[model samples]
Target chain A: MQDSTATNARDAGRAAQRAAEARPVRIAIDAMGGDHGPEVVIPGAAMALQRHPQMRFVIYGDAAQVEPLLDGHPALKAASAFTHTDVSIKMDEKPSQALRLGRYKSSMWRAIQAVRDDEADACLSAGNTGALMAMSMFCLKTMPQVERPAIAAIWPTVRGESIVLDVGASIGADASHYVNLAVLGAAMARIVFDMERPGVGLLNVGREEIKGIEAVKEAGRTLREANLPNLDYRGFVEGDDIGKGTVDVVVTEGFTGNIALKTAEGTAKQIGEYLRSAMGRTWRAKLGYLLARPAFDALRAKMDPSRANGGVFLGLEGVVIKSHGGADVKGVAAAIDIAYDMAHYQLMRTIRDMLDETPIATAS
Target chain B: MQDSTATNARDAGRAAQRAAEARPVRIAIDAMGGDHGPEVVIPGAAMALQRHPQMRFVIYGDAAQVEPLLDGHPALKAASAFTHTDVSIKMDEKPSQALRLGRYKSSMWRAIQAVRDDEADACLSAGNTGALMAMSMFCLKTMPQVERPAIAAIWPTVRGESIVLDVGASIGADASHYVNLAVLGAAMARIVFDMERPGVGLLNVGREEIKGIEAVKEAGRTLREANLPNLDYRGFVEGDDIGKGTVDVVVTEGFTGNIALKTAEGTAKQIGEYLRSAMGRTWRAKLGYLLARPAFDALRAKMDPSRANGGVFLGLEGVVIKSHGGADVKGVAAAIDIAYDMAHYQLMRTIRDMLDETPIATAS
Candidate 1:
């Protein structure tokens, strides 16, 4: 497992495709995951296959339930190898219950195990995040310096895209944890944005006069002073800075990060609703909506959550991508796309090397 | 001091206007405050005076700087009484430093002091928020049960409006503090919504599988179990609920609350930018924009921050309204309008009575 740091994402993608002609990148997917289960997951893999022609999938689920769905998509059927599993983890099952009962027996566990066993480059699941996370951490242990695995989401910003991490993996972070998140997020930014060094910032309250949470401030102080190997630490950024793409990586403790992420999403949906309701007010406006519907559709497509579907479980020994349970085939494909790209670029190797090379100290 | 808790805001407004015919509502304005100094504040006061005909102002600042601006507006000059002060608090001044240097000397300090000294029914400032809070807390003092004062903002929701409190007055709230914020927000909602009982919810991370921050979860549990006076506790709400109008009062500690508030505002601005760029993309889209400009204008008006201008400092013995520092005449007028209504309806007395009557214990 060598570092993929020498090449950028585009160059890596070209190299991966060239390698793909020789030995295809294998991805294990939890087929019985998410709301639509095999219905979306099957077609989604086929859709992803079109994007990555030299990719293979290890599908884990009840064969009786999965085989017929695979039969519908001959392209996916050719690319996939199905594993028979009797048990499927429920979406609402507690992490403890899933660990106690399902363990390595369930489809979700087996998919993650494919990564741990080095049979597959990565695993993708559209299931309950907590269960997926627990199973991933248990099956694929975290890297040496990593204490807790974080969920990194791809955020759409004014400057295109940025990576935000620790979006509710585990709560309460120290300066070290914040620094760890920064390194991991920046690494992902390189893999995704094709940048060698990515700018990172710590999230804090925007009030000018008042001090932020002690831990966040401490993290900010440490980041500002420390000479992190690959990360370009830009000190403090506020909640608004996230959408503005003020930095490539916006790092925060799990709790605040989770709240801010969801708040921004909620605000977007709220404004969308306001726009729709306003457009339907009059006949003239309704006609305008029909005439300008293409632009609105383009806007909607840009704002689509499906386009940015995956949440990479960072800090784990193996790569795991979490897809939204409620996501459609398009969304599932998007998640798979991320999982493939991460694996293709060897994102895990890059982050591990960065963390080993430089430990972000709290003081200096 | 009397509690006007018997009637709703509509009836209260009608009665208040009639009472103003008998005795004018006297308000103290920090004329030297905000970005534009007395230029915006003077016209803002005059605009407010037009709405509340019998309202009188005690404008505090340098007489030379204040009187000329007021003189430009004949209506404001007739209703104003000037109190010259040598100092004006800087917009970026620290709360502690403002207290040390500007206390009872600056216009901001004197306005709040006027409220405390019974010279004015309410005090309004468009200066530094932290300094204003410190001065308000220092001069006005907290009510019987409140250990910390909260700044309550009127958030525009799908169902019209809701009150969200502790939007950065102070940070770190206990379970008891959450309950206090709920009670305070609910009381303010009653004044704004014209409803006797307002529903309150504690903001928590939306994830179903994972538990939220201990403080937030504890606050939610406390709010769920406890029965706050004149408040309907709806257990927990996610960040999305702030705009969904899911609850009349959203209770959160200052830190999370402040982040959420700014995040929403930033997202709104971001989306607005997206719309502008997309609409300008093509000639047809521009034509459609022209046709639907009125509807878009209505939506803009609805999303206007100026319309929801003041954040009231609740739990203080006296009413203190903090306006946005960079607000124009219309926005500042909105702040004064809120001050007039709060004073006319005796919001200070209502909160005091509510706190005294119900301490909002952490648990039942």
Candidate 2:
């Protein structure tokens, strides 16, 4: 009986080790990229480690700026997997110009380099988006069948969540870029949500086939013609459909996507203020708020900015996540988790495999 | 004493008639437009009459569809200014195609004709925006000084409110269109906010000079060169600034503006849901809600959709206010009030004067 128990324990230990090795993932974080910089990023990193002990992190930025914030956290300090880069990409700097001028010194560039060099599995930043995209493209290069790298963010919706691509990656996009966005967004939905066949919708002024600008019309034709497998072409979707989660992925040019993102953020803030005031109006309303408080709390948690912090820069040779510059500790932690997930899933490898099987057409 | 009283009453009556004659303003409404068609429009028209008895209205669309809704409203029926066109524009129809096919038969066309023939001072529609814009331009024609008419909407901001132009007017806009939007948006701010010098911000990705697309760059240069009087060309503004309301007017292409507008609406809905959930989380939170009810109610009123329903389509030959398709009675009332105010202020005449004085220089 003793011999049988010992054999079972040994088998369980071996299985655990194998599982850990199979899912080995490391995330490189830009520790000095956000508005609050090291203060927010360090605590976020520590919290992420507590939540996901198996996940490894490389802290990139000024060591002097980051170390003091770490205090005596042994996992952050003594972990052989962690390291630092001594530079940062400023939020106000012109992305292209900064990339050209500060290529060697910028933390953003180094982080991408780490991912490219296989020093880290994925790179994450809360820095200038343009700088990050430019650096990532320059360092890691685009994936095998991709044209432009798109910044994709997953937005929570009524039905579920949908990924919006080219959020601010390529501005003034042509038909081909949008097609690539659709492809990348589909790939992301597959990995993120385990959605085998994701619905792709072209963002437009109206849902009708004939509505929208010339670019949208041309893009729609290209998307339909591509006939990508595991990509259900759902046609056009308007602004309202985004929150309604009518489609799994929404594709558009960076310019439109950026404006859409900002507008959503602004509107959310306004609505939150309004609702708080509404709940405070009368005794009966106040009582109703008490009765419905649990449901409301659950809904608020779903919509919290911290819960949706990280956005992936897709179509690159390596995985890269960008967090909002104004992210708090919780937001940073969320971004780290997203990066860990992308790395563990081997998102880039999956993208490469998919592209390898698919033939590349000339600009769609 | 009786004779003296009679003389005074007669004098007052004549004074009132003279006041009315001095400010004769007429407005044309597409009575057959919107989901409920004449049902909402007729009541809105009656409400307008109650608010602004001095003005005149020309109701365009099938008389049968509109007249039934106005039954028993003697004041509305007695208004000889009301004229009907026996046609309608369908919401689902393609704007460009419909405009061409139903050029003479559509109510939108007839409303534009009223403005062209000087039968109405301005025209309003809660119908298909593209159809309205196409018909308006076709019949009334672009004002000689204006390049392309843009649509402008008032978006609520933290500081107050800001005007966003080219909501969906010119889809494939160049630098010149953006410059025109800036001028139109600035002019709107001056009239609407009674500002002698309104600040205009070119909506872009970042505040830096080289951050935006080529069109935005060129528009920024053009705006700087024009140096219009009472215009504070404040260069570029990021997305967050839209809600901050640091600038009185924000100019962008219709594609970007539409996305921004829709995003704001979606975000607001999301935030409202979040806040409601948060308030319902705990017993203490519910108790606090009761105490803070009045203040919350005030905020809700300020952010209510009814108060922010209408957005004026600027640069057209006449006034046209677009209401939300999902607008309720209160929203419709708000839109009518906006139309009434525009007519009373002679907004179109002010725009015409401004355009007449400005040179037709290419916007960089």
Candidate 3:
């Protein structure tokens, strides 16, 4: 069974790799999604185009606002088809409210619709996370066998990077949801990390601390029992394992995952503040900081949150990426880069096939 | 109503302060706890004894193993009464199994029982967290109105330290449980941080996202409406807000709180690794590192995990502290220091009073 599953995955990977090499990935951009809107998105698309010349864009936004910015980037403009929409979702709008106020006519909805219509291979949004997720679910819908969609983040670790999923796409999860998260996250890790069988771990507390939530333990049993070929289930990992790169994919429910993600970001910022305050304490410290400018710059670059900007919406029928609302041009480009890879590799079909192959009964 | 609550708290604080100043705090030492056992615990107790001369100790452990170690610390030996207990809980023992095997005879359980029997003011242990919590709950039990006890950690933040509670004492929490956590955490914060009304915040996702769990929303309403005098309830705070010191006490369920705490620790460690690697990259960086030794030392001191080593078990009828099992002498001393402060301030009575004063009906 394992050998046959391996062979199946290899064939699928090879087929995806070959097709990706032959075609350009069409990305639908919600130009007026984030804080800076077209001012950042247009230039970000231009930057992404430079990295992957085989990328094309289908831009949707208010024409007057986005057209001027698009014209500023000649290369991106030349490879893009522009669509005009007068409405754009507000950053602070609630998910349900956003759906009511701007569902059909909004730039965010239209961008996701393009992907469903087969006009774009993938969709990218830098709007409100809740709004973007709601619209994506409404427009693209969940794939077969997927209970609900999840958001996956590329976490930077000492060993490189790992994929963490269910970072606040929803509130609660059951046993099957955990299994779904593990499978979906593994599929993303396989594509992102470029591995045949990405190791997956269920996020849990210390082993000595009375086993974690019951759903986590149940999911662990199911994953271990099934022993799917495309992914290796490495039992349980604690919160620290995410930064240690102990596994390629860390699966968790949305509530804890979101809190963990935000807490890490907060800690990094706190340390940065401490570092700056320490460095400015004395004249000698200031001189040392100046001399060690390169080291500081390197550290800054490594800890830059924008480098890991994109949050891929998993278990969907079409590829969707949600960039941070406050992300700058570089960060937006990072999101687009993920969209390009995911769309190019046909992640939706990959997830569908993997889901169909998984034994859901084992989870029960 | 607010003014009256504040005045009542102030009077209670003054009475507790006078009583604390008039007497010595006796701490029960589980000498068999932690990795180094009596070798580290004796020295740690000695160190804490130096700073707090009025502290007395009731040490429990295997006399054959602990007698020689105690003799090495003359002052601690003189101030402590030693008891021989051969049974000790293993680091990996399940909570239930630990109870069955080591409940009555073990050093960990006996230390907790001392507080309950009024033989000691407080208890301290560096044994298995789950075992300690189980023993603590079983021996000390919950105070009136507290559904279950919570483990509160003194979290280091940019502004200062914040008290975060329910960091894995138990898995799930209801609205009333959250209220208990908030009240208990605020009582500790008032003693540790020396504040009349320490600002409290409910740990939640971003205000913009869909509202958090139903229990969280319900708790928010309860805390807001009750308007307790001992704590200033500042609506909602996200995970990042913990590090920003946005609130004096950050309240959440054990599952998410534990994950957030561990995730922050992992992030801090990861950045430290990144910094070290960057500093070693070039000769200039090395030279600069040497020149800025003081700055690095300061940052290291700021980030030292040992400085915040104790987890105070709140909502209990008596004070109990769980130190890290892998902690060294300094870390153990830190935990003892917290135990001393909590005992001195009469935390149990403070919590009891607050619980009695709080309108529990509002929580539902």
Candidate 4:
């Protein structure tokens, strides 16, 4: 009986080793990217490790700073490997300057390079968006059938969640680019939601067929006529439809997408402010708030922006997740969570396969 | 003593008559325009009359339908004059159809005609926007030095309200049109908020002067260099600034403006849903909600879309206020209130005078 138990333990060890060898997702993080830098990113990585035990991290920053922070948490220290880099990209530095001067030296550059070198499954950053995008485009390049990359955000909706694309990757997408966004965004929605056929819509001012601009109209025409296989092209969706979860994917040019995102964020914050002021009006209201504090706390957790933190850059050969520069420890963890999921699901491979199969005529 | 009292009464009557002759504000209403038609409009007019005793209304629709609704409200009956019109434009009618078929005979057309004929000071309608704009443009025409009219909405902000323009008036606007929107929006702000120098901003994706498109870039440059009077052109604002009340006027082309407006509305509704579900979670929460019902009611009123329902079409020869299609009595009242306010302050005349005095290089 003792020999049988020993044999069982040996079998378990072999199974664990085989599993690691089969496929292990590793996320490369820009440790010196955001406002708090290593102070926030290290703790965030530690917490993330608790949730995702299989996940491994390669943190890029000054070794002196990042190592000390990781030491405070043994789990993160055990799961992570530090890559020393003295140079860090400044938050205000222009994309051109960052690319020209700190190409291979900067933490942002090295983090992205890890993914390109096949050392990491995905790269996550809370750095300067423009500089990051420039570096990413330069290093990874565009995927097959893609002219430009787009930032896809998991937007919270009334129904559940929807993916919105081109939330400030580049501005002024023509008809072809709009159609491409639909294809790319649908690829994201499928992997994120585990859906076989996701519904995609072009973001417009109105749902009426005759309402939007020429580019949007042409994109709608193309989407309708082409009949893509992976996604159900649900012609046009308005701004309100986004929060209502009218479709699986909402696609638009960068300018409009960026404005819409910021607008929604502002509106949510505004309503929150209104709620706070309302509940604090009278003594009776205050007591009521205390009694219902648990419910409110639950709602707060549900509405927390950290849960919807990551913006994955699609149409790139490698996966890249961008977190808000001002995001705290929780937000950083949220972004890393996205990176882990994308890598585990082989999101980049799926996107490449889908693009190669997609029959877009204007994919130049 | 009796003779002196008689003399004082006579003098007061003459003074009142002179005041009425000087500038009496009159609003024209399309009684059969919205979902509930006269049922909501007459009651709303009555409510508005309670607030503005000096204002009068011209009701246009089937006299048989409108008269009875006004009959129950003696105040509205006393404050309004009815014009019979058997034809009413359908809510789904196209702009071309509205202009072609319902030109002179329809209630919507005649209501706008009132403003043109000087029978009413301004026009108010809770009808299809496309149809209303068509009929308005045909009847009143664009003002001199104006290329096209734009819809300006009074957006509720943390600091009172700000005017956001081109909210689905036209799809695309050039640099000249953006400059025109700023001037036109500022003019409305000056009259509505009683500010001599309203702060105007071009709504863009970012606060950075280099972030937006060519048109917006050129507009910013022109505004900064021109140093226009009656408005302090404060460069560019972001989507969130509209709700934050960073400026008195927010300018954008129709597409972005409409989407931003609708997105904010959707976000507001989304938060409200979250709030409702949260408060209904448990018996304790239910009891707390009951106790804090008054505070919630106040907050609801403060966030009420009805209070900010009116979308005033500016740069037209006359004022035309558009209300939401599914508006209730309170919402209808809000539109009428805007009409009354615009007429009382002679908003159109002020806009024209401002245009004449302004030195815009592209006033063609």
Best by TM-score: 3
C-alpha root-mean-square deviation, candidate 3: 3.9
Order the candidates by lDDT, highest first — what do you get? Answer: 3, 4, 1, 2
- Candidate 2 vs candidate 4: which has greater DockQ? 4
DockQ, all candidates in order: 0.61, 0.30, 0.79, 0.58
Which segments of candidate 2 are over 4 A away from where they belong? A1-23, A68-71, A82-86, A100-102, A275-300, A357-364, B1-21, B273-300, B359-364
TM-score for each model: 0.92, 0.88, 0.94, 0.93
The superposed Cα distance between candidate 3 and the true structure at residue A280, in angstroms, equals 0.9
Candidate 2: residue A283 Cα off by (Å): 9.3
lDDT of 4 by residue, B102-169 (tens): 99989999999998887888889998999999899889887656778899999998888999998999
In model 2 chain B, where is the ten-residue run with the lowest total lDDT?
A: B1-10
**Can you tell me the DockQ of model 2?**
0.30
Best DockQ among the predictions, by candidate number: 3
Ranking by TM-score: 3, 4, 1, 2
lDDT of 3 at A91: 93
Distance from true position, residue A111, model 2, in Å?
2.5
Model 4: reference contacts kept, as a fraction: 0.69
Q: Write the per-residue lDDT of candidate 4 for residues A1-364, one digit (tens) a residue.
A: 1233334433443453344357678899999998888888888888888889888888899998988898899888888888899799999888899998779988999999998887788999899899999999999877646778999999999899999989999788889899888888888888899998899999897777888899999999988988878889998998999999999999998888888898898888787788799899998898888888898898888778898999999988688999888888899999999998888776765675566556675454
TM-score comparison, 2 vs 3, better candidate: 3
Our model 2 lands, by Cα RMSD against the true structure, at 9.6
Leading candidate by lDDT? 3
lDDT of model number 3:
0.87
lDDT score for residue B24 of model 2: 62
- Of 3 and 4, the candidate ranking higher by TM-score: 3
